[model samples]
Target chain A: MALNTGNKIPLYQQIKQNLKQRVKMGVYNEGSSLPSLRVLSKEFGVSPGLVQQAIYGLESEGLLAVQHGKGVRVLEKKSSESVAISFGFIQPYVEYMTFEGQIIHYAEKVFDRRNNFMIPKSSEGMASREREIVEHFVQNGVKGIILWPIDNDPNGEFFQNMSHRIPVVLVDRMVDGADLPSVVLDTHEAGCDVARHILGKLNCRRLLVLMDNLVISTNRDLIQGLSEQASEMGRMMDLTVMHLPITDFIQRLNVGDYSQVNMYIELVERQIREGGYDCIFCPQEEFLESVIIEPDMDKKFPELKLASMTGPMLTRSRKYNEFGVIRWVWDFPQMISSAADILQQWVLRRKRPTENVSIQIKQWQSTE
Target chain B: MALNTGNKIPLYQQIKQNLKQRVKMGVYNEGSSLPSLRVLSKEFGVSPGLVQQAIYGLESEGLLAVQHGKGVRVLEKKSSESVAISFGFIQPYVEYMTFEGQIIHYAEKVFDRRNNFMIPKSSEGMASREREIVEHFVQNGVKGIILWPIDNDPNGEFFQNMSHRIPVVLVDRMVDGADLPSVVLDTHEAGCDVARHILGKLNCRRLLVLMDNLVISTNRDLIQGLSEQASEMGRMMDLTVMHLPITDFIQRLNVGDYSQVNMYIELVERQIREGGYDCIFCPQEEFLESVIIEPDMDKKFPELKLASMTGPMLTRSRKYNEFGVIRWVWDFPQMISSAADILQQWVLRRKRPTENVSIQIKQWQSTE
Candidate 1:
């Protein structure tokens, strides 16, 4: 099968998986030099830069080596002392979904150390394309899969049935009805924490919670947590919930097109003005830094303390408090590493996939 | 090693582990007859009933068989195909600490199905004894260990360095300063849930939470959760904390001699009368069912409603509401199964142990 340009996975990862498979299948022998970069790039219908990146990844992993002025050559194989535990890595684009990309980065490092291999596949955030890739992996005997499932699918039921065939571990967000193992930040808990900090610490009562959509489990949980906190405080009658048109946007916001930023901004601004809201809470990490609520732009809404769930790199260097927001930071590395651990157990013929885990989120401290 | 009667592990389990080791080491060849029950009982210094139970356990796992006239015979061994993932199971006595024993039962069944094995060990509730068993297993090349760490240990630091030498998964309770993987019920969340249920559902303003000890993570989390809820509602001054004498009693209450339970009962009764508390919350599952606040005995305090975290069997067959108590039923099976999953990942030459997980607890429903 040829590479598809519209795939969400980076071009380099796609090529890397293709070449890795051929090497494992014995189509490419040990010590054999691969075709020149120009020839290989042309064959896969990609630029030479992408092919070189793929080759570099292989070289770094000890799968292949690049001698000075020589083509990439296959290295000696690590024998599977037992059956080599293998998994298919499904991800969105690295540039847009940096949190997920970083997780995959750590997972690959861990897999190498464990003497295991993972092949990545992407369909440009298209659920149908992902389904096809999963089918291909299953038919070809890939043992298990680690999926960063896209929330853009209208049906959202494709993943519900995917895990039935092989062990499928989702990262970052849980699907509503799927019995799949997932490693994710507890948005529900984050919501409760944010509510406490804003209401108790900042002395803010009228709060506005912003999220792309409720279909996403993380987004839905955020609302649930916030509502529960208010109800517990005997303030449910005082809680305000604002919704975006499409569901699952909090999860797939980066992958899907959302050109109407001003519309969401205007809606937020209107709610703050009319409701006399003292705080703005957004559990979606992507939206915290996105244009709709940009840092400098937050100055427009004076006296409004902002709250959000943050990724490791998002608020690390920034003076977040001065930007009028406090973050409940999530450990991205933990989510990725945990998913890999779960996949390893299941693929190695363990009886059943483990229960889904919701990682605890911590209030951001200056030390981190 | 001679079997000790003081072990927390059942005598049958101890003997089962002993015989299993001999079989694996070829001390007893495949199709060979094990020593007669009379000889084995005398040699191990155990009762004949215990020896029979041990042999029966082995037979059920396809490791041995009983013959009509001949002695109990060894059966053909199932090849491990891969490294037979092994863990030493350390637990409390099965008779009183029934919840933990049920967890072990399910874990053993999972181990059998996964083609793995676990040896059982216990020092009752003796911390020093537990340390010796852990040291012995570490030296014997056991791949991993699952410990239901006793809270009675003044220095929980014994478990501190255990995972450094090998993977150690703590079940139910987490040691204070130990860098180990653990699967436990989130007592802190249970604290919050209880606070909400008591304050909102029952509309009770004064709540008294009674537990054997605070060093127990569940009990500590319960207090933390309750205080946080009151604080979140801007009522920190109203939150009450009552401390017991022992630090780790919640964890080892059943094992340690707690004949002074009447002192605890008197304190609770006095507090209820003087403080005018309408509700009593106990996160300790064992205490919820034990005599500190007996079901029929609770009638003396006519207006007080009780709450506790429960195991699967504790409240299942009983009429809970009529007893003047509500339960936050915890899924022990989920806790055990999740720990099994975590252990499986660490023992198979994986790079790092996964993060500690706290299983979610749900409120009891009539349907369950």
Candidate 2:
């Protein structure tokens, strides 16, 4: 097809459209090489510069791959049919690397076969890095984005601007004041569920809750849920909460330091031995691994029914019930899938939910 | 192609395979009518029953559509290419309907375009319904399943059996000793986050944490986090947890019964007027909506900073910050995506993580 020089459309765009149609009609099949730029220019009576520009446009769209010596090859036929809708999934560092990997993997597995996903090569929870990732995805024309935003992100304007252009679904965290769709867990209900299990089902009256130094929103929800449940069972329940400073321990552990680990372990042992508590609740698994799993801690505190709000590392040498620990499981797949679904709908159908999605929590107990 | 009746392969299956190949090779274009059963039987020199069976098999696989008086029509030329790998997503109920719907939608969006998803028509957290849904998906050959399991599920054996056959990713809740993969949130940390926000950020010296009667794991974790943060701050923090008997209010709210909502509201008003507290923490949104949003509550408690561990219904008439309220947003999408990813891996590659995935929480303050 010859270019319409008098048309309002740019010359390069006109050439690009013609070649795109030819590719769609199977004149240029996938993996097949395209005609030389000189031949195309001569045939269309257009400058070689226009032909080069058109080819470059198609190359960026992932329809063509340019090889210096082998010539430009059609990477996909029926370009429109073969062009998968792309999505960007951005997170702050891979804290849960396997879990994050699985989310991307499963999202692709369950997503439409013609859709594609892109994630950052490395993320450090830095505002600059986050901005870079977001801008890159936007420039690449990703249909939508699923972000695990940085806590108290400073790049609110960037996110707000991006949201206006395309659907942005915040995953794990959200930036304050940014009007974006989000999918969050119902940790309040999770706390209530755990409290019910402990007070109603397990019939524990006097309980001691052990906590660490890290302050987070989930931690607050759990406390509220527990307090509410305890108050509901008032007089029948006696609860005491003990907070330990573990920021040092955590930082040291991260650097292969274990000196303070024993100090915290001994302190926990003392609390269990001295307090007349029917149940002991540890909010993190570090306490279980560092203190409870000691040689005969289970025997020493056989009467002390143990519960945690974290998952048990099943692969660890210590097994649940062996040390009498019960834990809760978070529904990550549901959260990821839901975010993807919402983002897709927002991108394809321009539909957004009236409220944020909240995933539920599950309880797990070891069977001996 | 003639049927090989003498061979081990059934005549119907052989014919079905031959027809399938032709469809894939574009011999029978999409939407074209196929020969009648009698005509096929005569042409293949086989019994009509075998020909009918072959056609029926193809029909079930979505290759052909049969109509009364009309012949079997090719629905898809590349039938197998379009068939999606389906997974079952079963939940007791969509109490969190928006959230649940988003999870399913995002899962599908990120899931392989060719893979499909199925859900129960109606579920009531009943063991029978759960059993039926699981069995149906299994019978239909779903690659895997993502379930919001019922507590103390009666169909333990069934789940165990299915786990042996295909991958099962448990969401929301889990049965005791099921040995299934799960994803859960860290409510303990959520609780800590709130405590730090109140005592450290807001500089609240005297805090009254109002809790309801529901005893759940998240509740316990929240209380633990609060107490831990409080203890770490030592003399700088004075915390009092008041448990209110609001089970009736909660039940009514669940079923659209708001009569007792006033009584709970009045109680909260009285507590604020006389309790001599600097801050009030509510674990759920219902309490904040019913009590704190009253016409003059904000004016009456001008010094009190309100916080909750749930998302604020932003579209509601009541505005946050205007009513001195801040809520935490849980990252549900991250949880769902993570779960979908893990489940997909387990189903497609037989890979399971050593532990469950936990999505974090974020805080949102009302801009108004």
Candidate 2: segments with Cα more than 4 A from true spot: A1-82, A94-115, A235-237, A245-251, A310-313, A365-368, B1-368
When summed lDDT is taken over every stretch of 10 residues in candidate 2 chain B, the lowest stretch is B312-321
For candidate 2, what is the DockQ-based docking class? incorrect
Give candidate 1 misplaced runs (Cα > 4 Å). Answer: A1-368, B1-84, B92-96, B152-165, B236-239, B244-269, B284-303, B315-321
Model 1, B165-222: lDDT tens per residue?
6667888887777777889988788778777777766777687776554365666677
Q: What is the DockQ of each candidate?
A: 0.01, 0.01
> How far off is residue A69 in model 2, in Å?
49
Candidate 1: residue A167 lDDT (0-100): 71
TM-score of chain A of 1: 0.64
**In candidate 1, what are the lDDT values of residues A79-161, reduced to their tens digit?**
21212334667765432333433444445445544545455454456767677667666644455788887764442466666
**B341 in model 1: Cα distance from truth in Å?**
1.1
Candidate 1: residue B89 Cα off by (Å) = 1.5
